[model samples]
Target: MKKFQITFKGQVYELDVEEIGSATPAPAATKTVAASTPAPTPVKSAAPKAAAPKAAPTPAGAQTVLAPMPGKIFKVNVQTGDSIKRGDVICVLEAMKMENEIMATQDGKVSEVRVKVGQLVSTGDVLVVTA
Candidate 1:
């Protein structure tokens, strides 16, 4: 059984979950067989751990909003040198058939525009540089 805390719709709640199963009992006939078999070696997966949130900027003003995921730049709403408010729509990236609004992470002028409409972008491809 595991207890977890979850928050949604402005309300937080505690949830208790129980596994539906009975514990296995040791059988006398299988006791020797279990001891004869070597313990299975644990598999160390080559895959790395769950990545940290990439949305947060590495450092302030050196911010460059990336694709977040592999996607195409659908539309660019802001241009170079435009003074933008925080959270302004800088571009639209279409990933998995959804148009995602790429927002300005800080209040600054768009110093460089690296993408345009209908351009396919990969992860970490600089879209716009703000300073």
Candidate 2:
């Protein structure tokens, strides 16, 4: 199971998500594991420490936007150095079979494009850096 901590209305909640194999079993290995570990066990780990902002100048010269979740790149709507406005569809990401529109959080020029079409990206991996 995966746990998510969400803050809402000044309150925090912990959600437990039970992950079943893909809606359909693609192979027989799924049956074997199910038979061995009758019940799914959840793993727990220590909380991650928060990162402090850098006081020195960033060599990149802009804020970087990353993939909010891991997924395959479906399409790109802008190119390097292209100016984008708030809420523009920057790219399409296919995660968990859903198409997520990655939007620009701020108005800026695209400084970098880090992934190619059809490429897979991980959560928090830099997708674009804007100047």
Candidate 3:
């Protein structure tokens, strides 16, 4: 039997594990217990604020850039009236602890910046509009 200690979310726990091999017969039953410890106090988070207002409609014939995945907007690289070309990085998205560059799909003038830094977005959510 091997003993191990692990810490998770500021809580420490002890564990016992038994290893068996194909050449060795397995025990019919086994039991293990962890050292008891007082539970940690629960944290209270503030109530969520209301959703932000929706962005204005995209201009006719404009190309809208959409979020590729659910993440927080790490940075916005372009603003309204900025000229951009195909493959230009429009913004940076932080998802799963990785930074992803959101690029423009078509060339045009940025008509609107629909999201801001630190704002959470979902897949298919509009990020920018270009015309």
Task: Please count the clashing residue pairs in each candidate, in the order shown.
Answer: 0, 0, 0
Order of the predicted models by TM-score, top scorer first: 3, 2, 1
**Which candidate ranks first by lDDT, i.e. highest?**
3
- Best candidate (score: TM-score): 3
Q: For candidate 3, lDDT tens digit of each residue in 1-131?
A: 67777665555667877776767755556655556855667444445566888878776788899999999999999989999999999999999999999999988999889999999999999999889
Model 3, residue 113: what's the lDDT? Answer: 94
Candidate 1 structure, TM-score to reference: 0.52
* CA lDDT, every model vs. true structure: 0.77, 0.80, 0.87
TM-score of each: 0.52, 0.54, 0.59
TM-score of 2: 0.54
Supply candidate 1's per-residue lDDT for 26.
35
Residues forming the 10-long window of minimal summed lDDT in candidate 2: 25-34
The digit string of per-residue lDDT tens for model 1 on 1-131 reads: 56677665545567967656649633334234476799877443344446654533334646677778889889899887899888899999999999999998889888778888988888877898888
- Model 2: per-residue Cα lDDT over 4-101, one tens digit each: 87765555679977668779634332234655576766444446555765334434568877899999999999899899998998899999999999
Give Cα distance to truth, residue 6, candidate 3, Å.
Answer: 37
Q: Which residue pairs clash within candidate 2?
A: none
